[model samples]
Target chain A: MQKMMQQVVCTVDVVLLTLQDSALKVALLKRGRAPFKDVQALPGGYIHPDTDADTRDAALRMLAQKTAIQPPYLEQLATFSGPARDPRGWSISVVYYALVPFDVIGQAGQADVTLASVDKLPRLSFDHRAIVNTAVQRLRGKSQYSSLPCYLAGEAFTLPQLQRIYEALMGEALNKVSFRRKMVEMDMLEAIAGEFSAAGAHRPAQLYRLKPELRDQLTLIARGL
Target chain B: MQKMMQQVVCTVDVVLLTLQDSALKVALLKRGRAPFKDVQALPGGYIHPDTDADTRDAALRMLAQKTAIQPPYLEQLATFSGPARDPRGWSISVVYYALVPFDVIGQAGQADVTLASVDKLPRLSFDHRAIVNTAVQRLRGKSQYSSLPCYLAGEAFTLPQLQRIYEALMGEALNKVSFRRKMVEMDMLEAIAGEFSAAGAHRPAQLYRLKPELRDQLTLIARGL
Candidate 1:
């Protein structure tokens, strides 16, 4: 007698996010087949067996294949599963959220890289809308108490640039003085030894990079802080 | 010409959690049949076709069926998908983290309510261990800035009881004064205007319940606080 085994299908989805024109934008791909054909959706694909380290790596591979973009920062977002989420059957998707510097993704300039405002994105396919909504909420929430927003900013950035990313993500303005104080108190930022070079801005403000040691500490602090 | 329809199989797993004797315990059920027969695992099953709300609803349904307990609070933890996560074929599990009052679970007292501590849990079957680990990390992370630990407390609880739950989940000790101050600042707790009748070694402390409005606020805060 042979024993029957239960089979399940898994997939990974990527929500590639970038800051463009002071607005947060997400990378979306147009589905090409039935099930939510021709609808705008996040870049995703099946969980390949040999090419990736984990679900996150699978998401990166899918993103690279579909959009020719390799996001610099990726984090696991919540997963979505519903009996009817897929018209097909019981499929579960592990969603990963990625933050790419505007210049990096903007450099790709693929037609699929739509720059819709985070607040006013098009109707996404499947439960993609809910997945994106939760990712945005997590991004905003972590930004309040961690150095995560720094990943969304360029390698080196002015305090205001960092603040703007927070504002864009949170959909609200923050007091510069208070925000700076909070950052300093967290001790996650390091002054880059001098002021910014005279560029296209008001007065050249000081530049800073996130302290490396602080990421793990922030990970722990962000857990319950 | 034939149009192709893509179908995927999905499942829901619940990592039901409660505080027992000042330690974090996860609810696991014994697998009765193959894949991993008779092995301990998180209580879960396939999403029923009829009357299932979503993956989350399906997880709740499974929990109810297995443990005869209904979690008042359930949140999507993450989706687990790997080509080989299941022995049969490609499978994905939509995992959910549930917080139920210890007293409520104790009241149910179902014969199968196997409460295993995070530190010394039995060898869990499948990727259920990984799923539970992920949920535990997420729970500790959320407990820091959210009022999540309060949910583990019974109807009425003392500050010390609440503090102990936080300590157990985070695996760290906190100063009582600072913890109280932080909780008060959040404005999510309302004092019950009385003291605990069952006194322990320490002085009988004041009791508090979560404010109703705070539930909505907590959902927001738990995302990243």
Candidate 2:
């Protein structure tokens, strides 16, 4: 006698994050079908056989398939499963979050894309608003103790630029002296011995690069740190 | 003309947490059929109309159906969707974490059910182990800033008992004075207005209960504050 076996279905969704015009933006693709036809949503799809690749790889693949942007950083965000979430049938979705440098994503200028502030956004399809809220909250909370904000920046940037990113995401201005002091204490930044003087700025501010070793260490520590 | 539709499968897996033997434990159920037949895994099932009321409801329903544990606290954890994650086809699973008070799950023992720890665990089916790991990490991290740990304790508990739960989840010993100070500062605890004596212990310590109103406020503040 064979035991009764139940078949389950799975899919992947992504919350793509990038900065535009000094505002944090999330990528939302317009769905073209019923249930949520023509509604804006995070880019995602069925996990393909090729999805055997690492989790990030799967997210990147799905993003690329749906949109023209290739994100640099991707992390597992959270999963959403409810019987009626999808009108089709029993479906569970593992949601991943991708953080791309604003410049990289903006270069594409995809017509269907729109950059919106995290606070004010359009109605999303299928509990995506909740997923994005959770991801943003996690990103903000983790950025306080980790170098996550750096992931949103390019390879090299001025301290002030980095500070602005943190301030924007945190929605508060941090005291310059105190913020830099804390960063120095963390030992996650390496002075680049260079300065940025683009766009006729007042003074050339000192630049720093995230230490690769420290970044990796922080990733491990961020789990429990 | 009808729009091209994409069909994908979804599922819901749950990490039901309970306190047993003064340690954190998770509920695992045995699979009755292949892909990892007879192996223990988190209680979950396909999200179907007859089976699951909705995506969020699936986890709770699965828990009740499989383990008969209706946990009070259930939150969506993450979604896992990788093409090859399932042998059958492309699948995505929305994983949920449920914090069941020790007393609520104690009833499961009456039904001859077992809850296991991460250390002494049986073989689990599929990416369920990875799902459990992610849930545990999130629980540990959130417990620090939220009153989640209190949910695992009895209605009333000693400060030391509460602290031990934190240490066990975090796998680290916190400074007693500092920990107590932080808890008091949060104003999330209230002395039971009396003291209780313990057997084979030094001195009787005052018991405290989580202030419900304060805890709800803290949850909000922790998200934005």
Candidate 3:
């Protein structure tokens, strides 16, 4: 019965992603406790079953306590579990990934949290490397036909600016006319009143922001950009 | 310390979906033990940390033991957890959704299992009703731009047969020319040697099967059907 009753360790981890200098980056912090202590890893903590309402809440709490950043968009990524994953015992981690603008992460000024280029990440704690990969894959895959890249482009941006962000995530240049057409199909953006990008002396492109209702959700298009 | 040491109940549930009579259906079983004994619910069981290699293994085990059906395509849907979801205590159920041909499920011949149309499901135990909705939504959403619906069409089928399966999941009629174009873009199917669907008066349609490598993974198209 003791073996049958053996408890599985439950925790929540966050893969906070941002776009910086045209490259995708993930937030990492030095583990303050044993079991990979002092090693850089995704922000994580044990789930407080008594106090936490759910895993999402636990994930938000861990982010606030560890990095002092509350992302505007957060979604559950996937759960990673196994007997050999953790040194302590059988364990499970309900992972969530958050998207934030580059400036927002910089504004948070998390001294302990460092941003690492996803393309050149160092050795991460536990299975965090794989977790980060999964999150990045999800972001890129969804970027094909959804407004997911908008979160990385900040609250307001010009069409050209948004296309650059999409190109960065998708790793390819998209046809401009078709890209705009797909954006129209998505219908998740609106012109920011009286706002335009200062594009030298030629033309000032109108700035746009995600519709209020779509800020927390993705607007998907049928044909990808 | 004891309160902090409290164990969260870990379980795995599967949402097995198939198409029966042109309607999307889900598999369910009657619970054999308390707390909700005799209740019809998604097949689920506790995680055997000592034996199961991972949560996916646990999910597969539950499906095999309860329904006697092994699916050709099974993917982790998401993890559902909270204190109130289960009366036992704080619990985590890693949910997986499987897609199989209707006849495969029928051939299993499990006496205790039953199929219910997704659109008209009866009251399910726990948060199962919500879980069912999520699975159905996932199926419908992916059906627009993926080979996911092919799993419900069986190993070998004609283009017309596949299109009908896609229509059933998508809940809309697709233009034939565009649908075939999208299929060509997906590039996950191949003509089966010397196989064709019989037609009473016209030419037989060539039978196709998913490419060997694409069977276990989804083939996603940029533009949807």
Best by TM-score: 3
Stretches off by above 4 angstroms in model 2 are: A1-11, A29-39, A46-58, A81-93, A122-132, A193-201, A213-225, B1-9, B83-86, B101-103, B110-112, B194-202, B213-225
- The most accurate candidate by lDDT is 3
User: What is the full ranking by DockQ, best candidate first?
Assistant: 3, 1, 2
lDDT of 2 at A16: 85
Between candidates 2 and 3, the TM-score winner:
3
Kindly list the per-residue Cα lDDT of model 3 for residues B124-204, writing each as its tens digit: 888999999999998899888888999998989999899999988988898888888889888999999999988889799
- Give the DockQ (2 decimals) of all models: 0.33, 0.30, 0.60
Candidate 3 regions with alpha-carbon error over 4 angstroms: A1-5, A198-202, B1-5, B200-203
The global Cα lDDT (0 to 1) of model 3 is 0.89
lDDT of 1 by residue, B1-225 (tens): 101102233567889998878778999888999889989989887655455666777887898789988886788787776657777544557788889888888788898778999878799888888888888888887777677888888768888878888888878888989887777777778878755647867677777888877553353343232
All-Cα superposition RMSD per candidate: 4.4, 4.5, 1.7
**Ranking 1 against 3 by lDDT, winner:** 3
- Superposed by TM-score, candidate 3 places the C-alpha of residue A173 at a distance from the truth, in angstroms, of 1.6
Whole-model alpha-carbon lDDT for candidate 1: 0.74
Clashes of 2: 25
Cα-based lDDT for every prediction: 0.74, 0.71, 0.89
Model 2: per-residue lDDT, tens digit, B43-103? Answer: 8876664555566777777888887876656777866765566765555667888886778
